[model samples]
Target: MREYLADISRETEVWTADVPTHMIHFNGDRFLGPHS
Candidate 1:
């Protein structure tokens, strides 16, 4: 069910790099802003 999938997603550990310190510079000069 959707609730079960949601629970699994919530409990999962997703690995990602920490937000870079210069991301603001990159955002201004490169990519768009972060999204929801």
Candidate 2:
């Protein structure tokens, strides 16, 4: 996977979830969600 992701910046923002919830994101600006 390193070869495939090597082009992306190391300073890239990351968001991860193992469970499910409602996520509302606007453009590439911000994320609005209950986030619980």
Tally clashing residue pairs in candidate 2.
Answer: 0
- Across residues 1-36, which tens digit of lDDT does each residue of candidate 2 receive? 334356556666545454445332223334544444
Residues 1-36, candidate 1, lDDT per residue (tens digit)? 323344444434433236643222212322334654
Candidate lDDT (C-alpha), each = 0.35, 0.43
Taking all chains together, each candidate's TM-score versus the true structure is: 0.22, 0.28
Among these predictions, the greatest lDDT belongs to 2
Per-candidate clashes, comma-separated? 0, 0
Task: List runs of model 1 lying over 4 Å from the truth.
Answer: 1-8, 19-36
Measured by TM-score, the strongest candidate is 2
TM-score of candidate 1 relative to the true fold: 0.22
Off by over 4 Å in 2: 1-7, 20-29, 32-36
